[model samples]
Target: MFSSTIQVSVFVFVTALIGFLTYLSCRGQNRSSQNQNREYFLAGGGLAWYFVAGSITLTNLSTDQLVGMNGNQMALLALWEFSAVVGLFVLAKVFLPVYYKFKCTTTTELLEQRYHDKHIRAVISALFFLGSALIFCPAVIYSGSLFMQSMFGVDLPLMYIAVTFVVVGALYAIFGGLRAVAVSDTYSGVLLLTMAVLVVILALQAIDYNFDGIPVERLTLIGDNDSPIPWHTLLTGMIFIQMFYWGTNQVITQRAMAAPSLKEAQKGVFAAAGIRLLIVPAIIVIPGIVSYKLFGDIGDSAYGKIVATVLPDWLSGVFAAAMAAAVLTTFNSNLNSATALYVCDIHESYVNKTPNVPKLSGYVTVLLCLVSLALIPVYQQADSIINLIQQLYGLLSMPILSVFIVGLLFRNVHANAAIGSVLFGVALYSAMSFEFSPMYAPFGLHYIHLMFVTLIACVSFALISNKVIFNQKAEFSLALYKEEEAK
Candidate 1:
């Protein structure tokens, strides 16, 4: 116990010190250095392709990848890992062009411009931001912390870690803005990927290069349909979920918006996709299969135990540090994005009318910190963080994607179509998840299934009503900012 305590303390201290140094390095340019609001959020329209790639990779490759996806793949599904590759293709080829042309801060801004309706923009933004904060962000933090607590045998209060996470994350953003987040993300991304590679190698070496001596069939994406998750359902559900996550999730898309050019941004997306394609099988799915092989009767809470028993002492400490970094990086990005949505989209547009840049930035940070702090207990007691994150995104994604796709592809989807689509999507998705069950009528679909249903429903609704909903063609002649023009 004493050795474990010393090890964790050393790891925490080193992490804090490195993060503080990163914060200092990024502190040079004040908020005034940003010439416009776009630069403030998008990193001065000059983020190199590498930083864009690193930030997006770090943002998407979080505790969910390590804990939830990895856990599921090891146990019941291998098709899930392949979704990362497929999703990357969609992001690189399908999603980037529209966002590049529109040049939006929040995804909902595209909706407002296309539909010419403030109500649609407000609803989409609110749902996206809330789902990210209340569900995805907190769940990832909780999953990572759960691993830490189990690994170190430290009964560290969830409240303490939650407060610390929010405060430090807010500091990174409020002071340095998006640039700070991007810079720190570069550091975190390297640390995370390196350690993940190490974990894979060490796990393989420990298992005598045979991957837990499992038979060939288990490694392949084929098995009986009677399994808890059939291969057919896994493929369909994961493809849609991955599309919604990579293409539309603000934390990931915001990194692309921070890129210097459309080309560089697309490169970043490609690089991120490449990394996911390589790491998913190595990091998450294999670990799960190995866990079951090494530890008998492994359950959802057994991931850390598997790692601790399998890895050497020094390596275990390193793995824990890497997991913590993943959690911290994910939490920080979400808090930063959520604050931006509130201050830029909601506050300045509605409440403040004219916001003081620095002061508003600080206020947004504090507001998010307090809200996250308040939710610590809720997160601690939550039974299923991964499930919650998926369900929240499932409920909220329909409208956001509906408007985004309409604006990008159709260019004539009416504002009312966007609004009606969101209303219908959210209500229907929620009802399907909560009200329908197998006993009642074999609602046998999961949350990921519902996300696709919502996506289709919203798209069909938008298309059907386009003619009547969009009575007049909206103007699209707003001049690009000087910085965007320079690009």
Candidate 2:
């Protein structure tokens, strides 16, 4: 049976209404000026804590978290959810302070400072773009959009609406810039949180009210002993997932920098982290588990079927809308950051030092759209969505985080040391990647391994090289003077 058209229409209308408000909020800004460039690029240093919190939360919560992570949780069923908690806390504590202290636009910028080298900056920035473009954004978009189109019978003509959503999001960033992205994220945050809570509540009620009540085992984190995803994989793999997500990814950190102040930035990071900690179990893991419990079997194809079949009419529609928003917010944020790197870091930094802002933003928007369209084919080629995201994150984070930690923590780190650490980090990560990620351990120590490897390598290189290659001027006075002047 089809979903109630009325409920579906209402859900669609509400989301559209939110989008309209976001557009209007962006209207007050100078959409086509050089002075507006930084604001358009960075939200003008005026990002409210609410939008910062919202955008960060929304960006993190996507089809990757929804479908891919949910799938992982159901596979491991217990240990994975706990890792989610760990990831949230790490983001709240470790990376948040470093980001705020430096006032970084890109995570790589922080690396450049610590390493005292432009090469380090350029390398990390490139990794972020490659990760988002080739892996993160496309996988989520194709999976989420395809799931909705198939579930709702949204034919090809109507299905293009999904592409329109991406285009609109790009324009929002291109024209209105970061301010617009922030406002749109606020709308997405409220809707995503409310809808997730609602779905969880409805699911709990459905389970409680249906049959002879929900089974106690369904509530347990460990589903069955025979599953391939044992607690071992869940715990170890989760450490990698969490640390990379919270500590390294720039799309998430971009919002942190946009916070009104350092205190607000901390609060926003903590708040968003807290919300994400709860959201994964509620909307993703719990529902997937419940669906398996009720339906008795849940293969990869069974996810969408379970949602439509189980939930009430209105709620199902709402779930559809929420999924759409999750994918859009995530894709939008990634695209915006990717363009910012292209415009601010690559074009403005090197090729055309004094390029016009409006024209550059416009050009970057067009380039990203083409790249995204090309990536759609790559997304179609991928089989395991989760694996794709993980692999991408793997290649991106290790090299970049190595450069960043050198910049922030290792004051004596030379440019060559920084650059050398990155080359080594990338080489090691690439070699260890498809394997067991020897970086991931059996104990909780697993999550910190990559961070440890990256940190140790950079710091060691910096220290060893400091005696010979120290830039006394850049280190003692010149860099200090530059930092003072930047302030």
Candidate 3:
């Protein structure tokens, strides 16, 4: 490790550049005075392919994935990033067009249009907001701060680092909006990928370019039944997981939603897919693998530890800046999306139809960041940040995804039926995942398998209740949905 002066100087210089570039990137966006909500929330619906690609990748790439996946210290974790390509493809081909057809400001708004039920839209948007506040926002800050502390060996209090992350993220979301976040994220995304590749190279060289010393199981992509990612789960649940996250999640999908045209948006997602295939696996898993070789089973600290151990001092500061940018990318994305949900779903719909959207959005962003800061301690107690995320996702993903599935697949599933399906899916998944006595992971099935059970069960419930309970007339027509979209 180099002297403290070098680390301090490099960190300051790199971070200053991050600020200057962010300001420069968002300057054009600030001057646009039209449709405040569209300009601020959705970047005036003007993102091109490259911005879409960069923003999506960075928003998803933070130390949460790096630390959390590497925390498992297994190559099997590459499945998470690799499988995301499928999710992006599905988003582009299947989901993105529908979103464009409807011209939704928020992803959950599509549910309202689909079912002609504002209540369901509110419920889903609330769920997205809750997930962001409780799970995503906190996890990103905590993990990024953890990585920073490990890399710099800083003596500062954890909350100080947490506050800095929260403030920077809030500024981007509050003032700069989606345009600002996307621009900064794109630049950081490129730098992060480049620096991460360097880490892999240096790590390999550190180990004398030999693989024999690394544990075979750590290097193997095939995960055993007990492994963090079982091989079978990839087939059973991974695809749906990817779709729910990339295709439907507000934080990630909002970037693609901001594109000015369907073609531009689609190209952005395609670029992300290419990056995922080539750059992500190398950066996300290789460092952790090298960490495992150097220091046995350090878990979540593996990424930070490996970066600190392998890179030169100047490079460490540079990577730290990239890491900060990654953390902020996720944070800013979540904040922007959360604010969008509130303004569109709750504030405009319920509180004030004529409210100043930009003003309200900024206020909401600040409040949410504080709440997220308060929740960081909850994540600090967790044994593994990624596992906690997956477990929590168990409660939300399949059930939420089912709502989209029913709406898109069956023209005749009534609003009440869709409601029942979503509610039942949530309840059943909760019971099985939390192991509430007799309802536990039915027949000793894995949670992912239980997701399949819950999705099928929910669909059945919706269809059954529509036919039997409500005796609702079944009508099959794309025209009904298109009518809403055209509005």
Ranking by TM-score: 3, 1, 2
Candidate 1 lDDT over 195-262, as tens digits, reads 77766676667677776467555576664554444566565556777776778777778888888788
What is the per-residue lDDT of model 2 for residues 1-487, given as tens digits with 9 covering 90 to 100?
3446866796688778777888787777544454544566677677777788788878877766666644543534434445656765676566666666666677667666565566666766777787777777667667777667655765675337557766766766666667777788778778777866665566557678453444554455654443434344453344755666667777877777776676677677667766756665567665666566667645443456556666667676666777777777787788778776766666666788777776777776666666666677676555556656665565556555555544654455567766666677666655554455564433333322444454456556655565557643224323432332221
Instruction: Answer with 1 or 2, whichever has the higher lDDT.
Output: 1
2 or 3, greater by lDDT:
3
Q: Judged by TM-score, which candidate is best?
A: 3
lDDT by candidate, in order shown: 0.68, 0.64, 0.85
| Higher-ranked by lDDT: 1 or 3 | 3
The alpha-carbon root-mean-square deviation between model 3 and the true structure, to one decimal in Å, is 2.3
Writing each residue's lDDT as its tens digit, candidate 3 over 49-137 gives: 99999999999999899889888877888988889999999999888888988888888888888888888888888889999988999
List the lowest-lDDT window of 10 residues for candidate 2.
478-487
Steric clash pairs (candidate 3): 71-299
Q: Residue 71 deviation, candidate 2, in Å?
A: 2.6
Shift of residue 41 alpha carbon in model 1, Å: 2.0
Error of 3 at 444 (Å): 2.5
- Count: clashes, candidate 2: 2
